[model samples]
Target: MKTTTAFPQASRSRSGWLIAISLLLLLAMALISLGVGPVSIPLETVWQWVLQRESQESLSEFTILSSLRLPRVVASLWIGAALATAGVGFQCLFRNPLADPYVIGASSGAALGVATSVVVGGTWSVAGFNPTSMFAMMGAIATVGLVFVIGSSRRGTSSLTLLLAGVAVSSLANALVSLLMFVHDGQKTMVILNWLLGSLASSNWQTLPAVLVLSTAGMFWLWMMARQLDAYSLGDIASQSLGLDLFRLRLSVVLAASLATAAAVSTAGVIGFVGLIAPQIARLLVGTRHTLLIPMSALLGASITLIADAAARTVVAPAELPVGILTAMLGCPFFLGLLLRRPRTYSRPGRRGG
Candidate 1:
């Protein structure tokens, strides 16, 4: 019997149009998100503001748009894109449909790092990164390293082992975070809880630049490896037989994904399920080809994040809900549905009647 891969060459032809549509949809969502909040700015005004054609009478709108909403919107886009792109990288590398930063403990670890920093009471910065971000990056990398080490054996890491190890590590990290919150003062505890729940409300111009740079660099590096990921999707033996260096591919993917995840967690405080949900949806739409999948996933992720943020802001006016809570509510059901399905569900990408 001939070996087969999930990604078919035929899908490549439509990737351009798919990405174009996704970009358009993401733009629409961003525009809508900008206009939604405690004070409603009309979509028309939002568009006018975007074009720098705002009337002098709309100065208040301009202040809210430029000073408040824009940074949060931009952060949502970049952070969501980073997480979703990292999800693609992780799922490809692990050859597991369920793999993601949140599921694999990277987010928990990063959050714990941030909590630790808060407890330590630090005012430190390195290369435009505050102590929280530095610790987050380190924690993400360390947790991923631990998972790989624990999952590895004489035959190397298996998907099941990695998944199980990740769950155990995630639980451990979460517990430690809770302990820190319990031991700290009320103010520190409040800060830790806020970060844990995940909010883009605090995203401002000051920190947005660093997040943009890190996420862009990390996601770009992953995008460059799309070809390798597609090859790896063919399975370990086949990819290695094709002269693909599995070790190099794994290292590159893990590092890039971890960096992206860290950037997101540090900025948005560990939003869950975007990474898990976005790539699967993208794969269903565009097939398993990472080139198409990456961009589509990024756009979808951005749109989802924006919508969640909009709801978080407006759902309880004056008192906002954490964006993470909304994503978790949406993702939990979708994740459970995916889990209940037969294993064959993922055998063919973009095929509905599998």
Candidate 2:
């Protein structure tokens, strides 16, 4: 006798309320982020600045609004959105909530690429490209490709196998990075350390286009795969039974997600936890439905990063903390709490629909 439990009506209603509340919270956080910084701006001034409304505001105020704060805020928004959307896609692909965008070794690959560009590329210049960004993208793609090849068996890819391969690749990349650091002098060491720490200090309008392109494409691609992702949550056999082409679906997701991640990391370095935490928060608000979860997660992720960036700038006054450090500091405890919550177990074979 096969049985299945549908969500209760009350549960559905509660989910709706949670989603609404989450959206409100995101908007509030964004506004708060724009207002708080090393030099605080009045809410009215921020509003005017955002709307391009000129006021009798001082030069310092204009500098803070236009030159310093605006680019960083925008970077936080897009970067966070990219990571969160990618996280959702990755978690769905692996069928593991603990899985993150970095699980496929993209982060390590990006790091290696950055290291190579800094160490080998004289002056870190290449005709038109920023060598660091270019190398990071290349490393990310190569890492994904390697993981795919290593994880595939005669039957096709196995989640367990793919995860293990990623772990191996990540370890190798980390070792290489460490070795490079060990051999470098003080100046080189400082450059590598700062890059690894992750900062939004370098953001500008010039970097926005690439981030927008990658993020928009990735989000659209993931949304298109919403049904397939839902099917996968039911298990491999269930997805196959539903006419989903597992290999093709997985490839598309990985490609889209990896590209988005690579673009973001190339510009911002590794900003951890946006992908992992954003989706979980979205799920808590919107249940397991991918359609709502994906976009909402993107928004929430942006809000979280923007808020964290604001805190980083304000906490030290003229000195700044790495945005990545702030994210991990917040995300780690939340992750531990989730682990201790003891999630429900679904029987393997019983994953098929009623």
Candidate 3:
């Protein structure tokens, strides 16, 4: 009995350590990111600036930190966390390790929306959201809604059915975006293309509030569903038998995740793989308790995004690669390796043995 109790306690201790380390890593990455851009600042200086302590850095350096890098880093942190948290939710909801926030056509729909806005050449703003962001959010929500409606049955929503529906919608939306890009003028096309490739170059204090609010709400909502999601791992019938409303859970999760994805894609432009990679890595580190998994995933996601964003800014120097491209470059290899490795083993929490 003591041995049995010791094992669970040991696992908990390890998870706690991992979570603490993840938080520290995320903080370190955020600081590193703030100092990484053109005209680099020192780490100590970055820390001083963050803490509002006097520093020898010039006013221009301070301006760059405050006006530019800070917001972008903050955006990356929250957006990554949101995407990763949403990823955990979707993965549990779907019972598929490969499932991500964008698995349900949110990225494609947001891309289409942004592409449409760029083509239309609008300068409108509503409640801190530009025309592009507004359209992106609308597109994501609508696409998710469409997929849910099509995928859901009278009995309940099946993961496989929803997955198929998402794939179809995503393909259609991607096609539409491509068509728009092909038809538009070169300059506008380039704008849309850059956005589709995903860049945080545009993230600024002016536009971050809306993203923060939406993402926070979505993440918190999803976190609240942690128990339901955990119950789901017992299988759909078991979950339903436990007085969990399967339909409501599906709807709430899809909606919450869509909200977070829309906020992210609208700001960062369809960054992928953070959602897929972070959650899996988190599960590997801390095991599969949704309560721990969700927060650990958030930290890992934030750290990964910061690293990718920093690399995107500096890897080419002066000519920045889109962060999204960097993430894909990183993600694709990881994804293939995930498949080639013990995918079945990795998919389960705390049960690595075949």
lDDT of 2 by residue, 85-142 (tens): 8999999888888788889999999898888877885644443347777788888889
Best by lDDT: 3
**How well does candidate 3 match the true structure, expressed as C-alpha RMSD?**
3.2
- The C-alpha lDDT values of all candidates are 0.85, 0.81, 0.87
Off by over 4 Å in 3: 1-8, 54-57, 153-155, 346-354
Q: Which candidate leads the pack in TM-score?
A: 3
Q: Give, for candidate 3, the lowest lDDT window spanning 10 residues.
A: 1-10
lDDT of each residue in 273-325, candidate 3, tens digit only: 99999998888788888878888998988888888999998988888999988
Per-residue lDDT tens digits of candidate 1, residues 192-230?
A: 888888999988888889889989998999989988998
State TM-scores per candidate: 0.88, 0.89, 0.92
Ranking by lDDT: 3, 1, 2
Higher-TM-score candidate of 1 and 3 = 3
Over 4 Å off, model 2: 1-21, 122-129, 153-155, 342-354
lDDT score of residue 298 within candidate 2: 82
